[model samples]
Target: MASNKNQHFVPRCYLKPFTIKGEGAAINVYNLDRRRLITNAPVKNQCSRDYFYGQDDQLEKAIQSLEQWYGSVISEIIEPGYKLQLEHQYTLKIFWLFQYLRTEGACRRSAEMFEDMIEPTGLDSDFSMSIKEAVQTAMRAFAENMEVVSDLKVCLVRNATSVPFLVSDDPAVLTNRWQLEDKRTRGGSLGLRDAGAILLLPLSPTIFCLGYDPDVYRVPSDSGWLTLRNATDVEALNEFQVLNCRANLFVGSLDYAEGLHRFVDEFIHHRPAARHIVNFAIFEGEETAEHKKYRVVSKSDFKDAHDGIMHAQTISQIPSQWPSFLLRRNKSCAYYNGTGIGYLRQMHAAMIETARPFFKVSPYK
Candidate 1:
């Protein structure tokens, strides 16, 4: 019997609206013309090679070492009963036992310190030796920087294409239950918030290596107004930062792997959001090599998202008469300081607008 070609089977996969647990932020890594979401390909030397001193061969060796070690680490950490499998298109995120050391500065230090630690590892190959040294350095750093945060979690994730986000054979990464949905869904997992700092490495276009801090976000135990305020403010700030990275990728044309480091340093790492347009202009207008690499077009184009985040933070800090949900989408007020909704929506809108001119159909797609 010939099956009907026009048979309409209800698709088991469908989009769902859910919060990204802690951060609750969404970014348009979407290419509108292609009608598909764009992901940051984790290539080390794509946009710049400052980390590896501009040597492609060295970067390649480092990546190979990382790939080799990733398996052993997984076997040691993953417990039985956890059904995880290693897949090509998955994302890899590593976590530190200490929270503060998750900072970019500390991560940089870890890499440098690895050079020192490798002396004792006695690994023969340069790649193996380099990684062993880095691991040792990271361990020492973790011990030195240990805090009250939870135990370290080295996670590997199947991409958003899979539902329920669990694999059968790969090493277990996430201990918690994660739901996967369409990337374009309005309220979907555009970004994730973790308590620790992260060293996000893109192993390839599909695979990502994320190194996180030990702490995890949790709801406040106490119901004090100050506690709630602080928590909400943190969440809002995290959301803004995640969106900021997306804007940089899509609008600033920053390389997925290298652009993050530069974006963090310039915008959110140590510096507070510059509220004034002039300050933002100066930040964007500087004739730096990074600006050239990302092709910073208009100073004002970059300033919009910064201003929006600053405004959002300002609004979030004030004693809110309304609930947090209302605050996230409030768009009625015209001014940042005025009594109205939050600035995230406006910020994202501005990001999409800026990305429109640069939006191209993905060559890979």
Candidate 2:
């Protein structure tokens, strides 16, 4: 058979749990740009593009193989009385990392960062590459990244509200409640291995898997599940989808389209201001002055949340209005109950990718 041309960055299997009746064919989507709700959108084409990873099918096949495993894992996740297990924890964390990295949203943000980094330098257009090429290059390093985050602790979050959890074109969200809220580092990026680093992915409408740095947040998960009984907490979690998604958001049913619209309308302002932040600083070359060479010193990042989570704005003002479920360590390195600080100095993955572009022209030379 001809290599599949329509490649999906968000695998259909991963979205199945959020599809209408878990049928895997249809889903509900809220498009932020359009301010529109699309009921029963075709799951197959939702987050796909033609040959997204290139004409080479190897990456596609590789993703498919792991996706097959993820499908089985979801099957178990949906089973009644499913408790998070060591084997399942590993499976979910690995899959979570894969889902976080492989999405179209993730690759596009990186590709944009690549172009933006060189654009100010007037670099030749010939040096520019497409998102697909970026995806291919990143995939080459996927195994290495998987190694870095293998140690993240995993737990399941059960949503006990009438509002089901939401998924997005970029489903896996990496946030640091500890880093962002810290007055010392409110705008700092979250490191994967850093204290209070948290990763979340909605498994089905009712439950999502959470990974964290055990040294930071002390989730009381002896039963392997943290239940979100408060609707506000569920909404707070859903807002992360809004903050992290490229354009589209997914839920299990059209029944939620109306409420989801209202929910998004209320907090859509919280979405990251830009896709990637590239900060550039120019400094003194040396005593040689004009004769010496200098570095541009640009730092580009993803999952750029300098302002913290949407509810954080409200919660910060109200103090005790939300996020009751996030438990903090008595003496952890991170801070607060649960807050997404910034990007990764450690996990080194962010969804939107920030473009700081400081580009300081002054040199001490």
The candidate scoring highest on TM-score is 2
Evaluate all candidate structures by whole-model CA lDDT and list the values in order. 0.26, 0.71
Residues 1-365, candidate 2: write the lDDT tens digits.
31898888888988898898998999888899999988877888899998887876666678888999989988988899877778888888888888777888778777777776666555589888788787877787677777667767888888878899998999888877765666654655555555466788888899888887765667776678888778898887788888888899988777777798898888888766675466654434354633543344433321232221111121111112226666766654322222343323233332224444111111101
* Best prediction by lDDT: 2
- lDDT at 83, model 2: 75
| Stretches of model 1 off by over 4 angstroms after superposition | 1-64, 71-81, 84-365
TM-score per candidate: 0.23, 0.81
Off by over 4 Å in 2: 285-322, 333-365
How many backbone overlaps does candidate 2 show? 30
| Candidate 1, run of 10 with poorest lDDT | 8-17
lDDT of 1 by residue, 24-126 (tens): 1322232322334334322221122123212235433543444345544433323433343333112233222222232232234345444333333334446
For residue 12, model 2's alpha carbon misses the true position, in angstroms, by: 0.7
